[model samples]
Target: MEGPPVKIVALAIQGFVGQVLLDAGGNAKVNKQQFLHQVCKRIHSIGKNLFFEFKEKSFKLHFLMYGSYRVNEEKSR
Candidate 1:
């Protein structure tokens, strides 16, 4: 059986806000959760889906999906 080959695709799209942050600084003081929160806030303000996942080293956030946006701030029961 042939297994799935590893692949990585980077999109070079325009209009990415806070692109400079990808280089360095401003986020060192904040924790992972804090950074995620801030990003989520910004995405919500712009009405977009805040897709995120955390790995061993960093948190990955994607805000490309704009149509089916939803912000869940309600406390879980």
Candidate 2:
């Protein structure tokens, strides 16, 4: 698939959020299910930018001026 569907977006967001909240020195920690629920509760958001880091790699997704979509996913990169 070129541009992933909304489901993929949701999955990616969930993963990103989970990684961002991984084991910390404090006690405020959440499990996977709770994280997903809390994240999905954000019914609204602004901007077309998303970013995350995993392992030693980083990712940044920008939906462009048109909207949160991609007609040519490769070129968009």
Report the C-alpha lDDT of model 1 over 1-77, residue by residue, as the tens digit: 01111011111112333332222222235454433422211111212223222222334333343221112233346
Task: Give candidate 2 misplaced runs (Cα > 4 Å).
Answer: 1-12, 15-46, 67-77
Given candidate 1, what's the lDDT at residue 11?
17
What residue pairs clash in candidate 2, if any at all?
A: none
lDDT measured at residue 42 in model 1 versus the true structure, 0 to 100: 19
Clashes of each: 0, 0
lDDT of 1 at 36: 42
- Cα lDDT listed for each candidate: 0.26, 0.37
Tens digits of per-residue lDDT for model 2, 1-77: 12344436645456334333422221223333333222222211224444434444433445455435322133333
The number of clashing residue pairs in model 2 is: 0
Cα-based lDDT at residue 48, candidate 1: 29
Alpha-carbon RMSD, candidate 2: 13.1
* Best candidate, TM-score: 2
